[model samples]
Target: MLAMNYRGPYRVRAETMPDPVIEHPNDAIVKVLRSCICGSDLHLYHGLVPDTRVGTTFGHEFVGEVIEVGSTVQNLKLGDRVIVPFNVFCGTCYFCQRELYGNCHNTNPQATAVGGIYGYSHTAGGYAGGQAQFVRVPFADVGPTKIPDELLLEDAVMLTDAFPTGYQAAEMGDIREGDTVVVFGAGPVGIFAAKSAWLMGAGRVIVVDHVEYRLEFVRGFAQCETVDFKSVKDMALHIKKMTDWLGADVCIDCVGCEAAGSALQHLTGVKLKLQGGSATALHWAINSVRKGGNVSIVGVYGPTFNAVPIGNAVNKGLTLRMNQASVKRHLPRLIEHIQAGRIEPHRVISHVMPLEEVADAYHLFSSKLDGCIKTVLIPPGVTA
Candidate 1:
């Protein structure tokens, strides 16, 4: 099997690796038909996430056909087309029983925070991802959902991570009808969050980003306003002005550790490794929401401490909610949204490349080249 190999920072290649076999009674082997290079994958590509081993593959969003299943995997079988959630978990655990699949206690029990994440890093259970011809899915019964026959492979793949994540971000915001919601970042997650805000009855939705193409794309896709943060002198102040000086009713931080706009944050967090990725977007979120408003975070950040505006949040009485998207929990409702044409997840895909060019795909997405919003990688023999 050919898989994306992580060599070092800013380096990756397609290399032949041993095919995965069922290792646990609940395990299954999947022949990947479609895989995605998520925005969070750039953290590993840029050597930000801790303990990302050199030989590990990096991908979490994927849809595949089950080729084999273990003895205990009764929910799935050979020839089943499924979309595997990014989380690997045992469904009977305390957290899983409560529908908090991302924090399942049985998987990655060594960590105090975050559960098993496919292809993230050692900190995320060290599970191999689906950025290859095949992948091993653990706790298969609880995670993989059968893809609806009417759903496109592209949209089905997004359900594995991006769509659910974005929806969760907005869901956490607790947006009230007629409230003004502001989203930070215009990546696929942010775009989805902005769109979800509308579905949640938000009167106004504004997406913020430094990239013109992304800002333009989200404005159309989400049917909301956009702000190019690079053009503003002070992001928080600009957002306040947009909201009539009282600030937005809700603010979302979709941009995590790698956020720009702060020289000090970039220098100390990103370049010096002094803190978990930059907190620029978080700072804006804390400072730009109205008093007593909500701040929802779906952005991926390191486990280490970040220089955030905790004081401002406390003083303003803001409700700050954040967590990895419980992809399994949101799957059923999101499937309905997709099937009804309420949201077109595949429209976010700007590029589709062959899995053989995984290296180039990484560079293109990380560099934000070619107006790339989302890139889906198709395995060598698979057709998009």
Candidate 2:
């Protein structure tokens, strides 16, 4: 099988690797039909996430056909096309019972935080992702949902991670009807967050980003206002001004560790490895929301400490909520939304490249070239 092989920071290429086989009783081998390059994958690509070993594949959003299944894998069988959630979890655990699949205790039990994630890194249970011709799916019965016949494979793939994460970001905000919500970052996740805010009855949705193309894309896609943070002197102040000086009712940080804009933050966190990725977006979120409003975070950050504004948050009495999206928990409702045409997840896709050219796809996406918003990789023989 050909897989995206991670060599080092800024280095990845398609290389022939051994085909995956069922390793556990609940495991299944999937022939990947469609996979994606998520914004979160960039963290591993840039070596910001810890313990991302060389030779590991990096992809979490994918939909595939079950080629084989183990003895205990009763939910899936050969020829079943499924959307595999990014979370690799045991459905019966305490956290999973509460519908917090991202924090499942049985998977990645060694860690005190985050559960198993496909192709993230050793810190995320060292599971191989689906950025290849095939992938091994553990706890197959719990995580892989059959793709609805009415759903496009491209749309179903986004539900595996980005769409769910974005939707979860909005849900965590607890947006009241007519509340003004400002989303920081215009990536796929941010765009979805902005879109979800509207579905939840937000009166106003604004996306903040330094990239003009992304701003333009989100503005058109989500039908919301956009802010180019690079054009503003103080992001927080600008957001406050936009909200009539009281600040937005809700602020979301969709930009994580790699956020640009702060020289000191980049120098200390990204360059010096002194703290977990830059907290620039987080800083903007904490200071840009109304005093008693909510701040929702769906961005990926390192496990280490960040230079966050705890004092400001405490002083303002903000409700800060964050966690990896429990993709399994959001699947059913999201599927209904997609089937009903409430959201078109595939519209976010800007490029579709063959899996063999994954190296080029990574470069194009990470560099933000060719007006790329989302790139989906199709395996060699599979036509999607």
Report the poorest 10 consecutive residues by lDDT, candidate 1.
261-270
| Model 2 lDDT tens row, 1-384 | 999999999999998999998798999999999999999999999889889999999999999999999998888879999999999998998999999999999899659879999999999999999999999999988889999888899899999999999999999999999999999999999999999999899999999988899988898889999888878899888988888899999999999999994688888888878899999999999999999999999988888889899999999999999999999889899998888888899999999999999999999999999999999999889986
lDDT score, candidate 1, position 71? 96
- Per-model TM-score on C-alpha atoms: 0.99, 0.99
List where candidate 2 sits over 4 angstroms from the true fold: none
Task: Pull out the clashing pairs in model 2.
Answer: none
lDDT of 1 by residue, 11-98 (tens): 9999999999989899999999999999999999998999999999989999999999999889997999999999988899889999
Cα lDDT for residue 173, model 2? 99
lDDT for every model?
0.92, 0.93
Best by lDDT: 2
